[model samples]
Target: MRETKEINALLHLIDDPDEEVFSTVSERIVSYGKGIIPNLENLWENTPDETTQERIELLIHSLHYRDLKTNLSDWGKLENPELLQGALLIDRYQYPEVSFNGITQELERMRRNIWLELNNYLTPLEQVNIINGILYNYYKLKGTEVAYTNPDEFFLHKVIESKKGNAISTGILYAALCQLLDINVLPVNIPRQFILGYFDPNYDVLHAGGNPAHKIQFFLDPMTGQVFTHKDVETYFKRISVPPIPTYYKPLTPKRTIQLLTEELSKCFGSQPYKQAELAQLSQLLGD
Candidate 1:
């Protein structure tokens, strides 16, 4: 079992009841005793919805294919839910492939271009300060609604708008670029709330976030068009009894990243199997 923080996070989402969560979990969860499977099965039997049933079945199939000691590599580059069948499906964020296509590419291109240009214009510090420039550009172009554009929304909407470049794509770009630029980053898919990011030299690990990275989270407030304060984020974290902390980077394996994304997809789409599997594979890549 990997003890990395991201691994811990990915494990947390197996129970997320979201499509993206399940999809992401599927790709990760490389280590286990099959304990989660039984729980998943029980949930499957109790789930009354057809989509849920489909998702539960597919997850069972995905689970059967692995066990402890499965070495994962090369899950590879993902296309949007547009080019493939998989996406973030079953979470509170519920994005379907049909919704994420157009947005993913645009965000990717934008991030890539920005990073490509930034090799000259700014240092990592300035880029961090001006980071909102990317966020504003993303939401403005997507016209992301306040209701669904939280952190998880980025995961779902990226797939929901599959080809058009949405938040998930934005995050993907953010993570990839940050890594390329030697910045520490992590994604928090807590619920229908803002997405939080962590970065600082003291807590940053070049490759993996161990137990030491002190992370702070900030999310955009669509209504105010500004970032939320600690007080604002604390209210939501309290719902889960998770007090706000400055150092919160949870290092996870590349596989876990995919699992988290898929788990969210499953929840969003009510766990439709074919789409769930498709999205899980597409979003499976997890590295710089």
Candidate 2:
């Protein structure tokens, strides 16, 4: 990071016209990792050529992306990784410099508001109602249909900042809140949909061997905070001609949920080949 002779030489060769020379220099620059970003930024500020500036920008992005891959790999290794933390890592893919402390604080505020209304006597449905009332009604968080045209809809920070997100982002937020409150709500592997299931608290202890679907009292659509009964899910399976398998009803682990999020987010980058490849790699890292 200190402007040593080697770093100065690399910075000077950034304008090399030969592709092989530039690629070698770029690799060496990236080898310095994220700590060299400030030096690159200063170089970008003084550089006159737009092409050279673009090259510097790519180098900076490469550094951030390399760091993201390492962090995500570490996150995947966590036995019980926090869902919010996983989602924030994905958010950082697009916004490398953004601070997520504000996002965490905002979530804490929402959690405290819901906690104030919660009591031991409230039914599971009632608890969900309070969450829905506060999040959807009071906080006015909105959910939109998943559309690949807008990449921001896939980011958690953007979702909180704008109060709008697609099904996946909103579902992550919904499940995250449930996690903070120690509720049993979780995302299920429902085909072609992102939905949460409220598990019976005693099911794990009492009937772990039985069909997992029997453990769910109801399903929730994160898009609108609307509840769905078993009958509704059954009808949906019939309409779609997909058998209602027990596995689909089981809760996805936090790591798997983040993997699915990365997979879905990758779709948004189809037009950008390099970006799509990078996202695909990120998703694969989570899977590994």
lDDT of 2 by residue, 104-199 (tens): 999999999999999999999999999999999998999999888899999999999999999999999999999899898989889999999999
lDDT, candidate 1, equals 0.46
**Model 1, range 84-189, lDDT digits (tens) per residue?**
1122222212322233445456546655755654645564445655555654554343434333223455453443343233334444445544554455554444
TM-score of each: 0.42, 0.97
Checking candidate 2 for backbone clashes, the offending pairs are none
Model 2, position 256: C-alpha lDDT score:
83
Candidate 1 — which residues are off by over 4 angstroms? Answer: 1-73, 76-109, 116-126, 143-169, 189-194, 202-231, 239-253, 268-288
lDDT of 1 at 239: 79
- Alpha carbon lDDT at 60, candidate 1: 59
How far does residue 98 in candidate 1 sit from its true spot (Å)?
A: 14
Measured by TM-score, how close is model 1 to the native structure? 0.42
lDDT of model 1, residue 40: 60
**lDDT, candidates in the order shown:** 0.46, 0.92
**RMSD of each candidate?**
14.5, 1.7
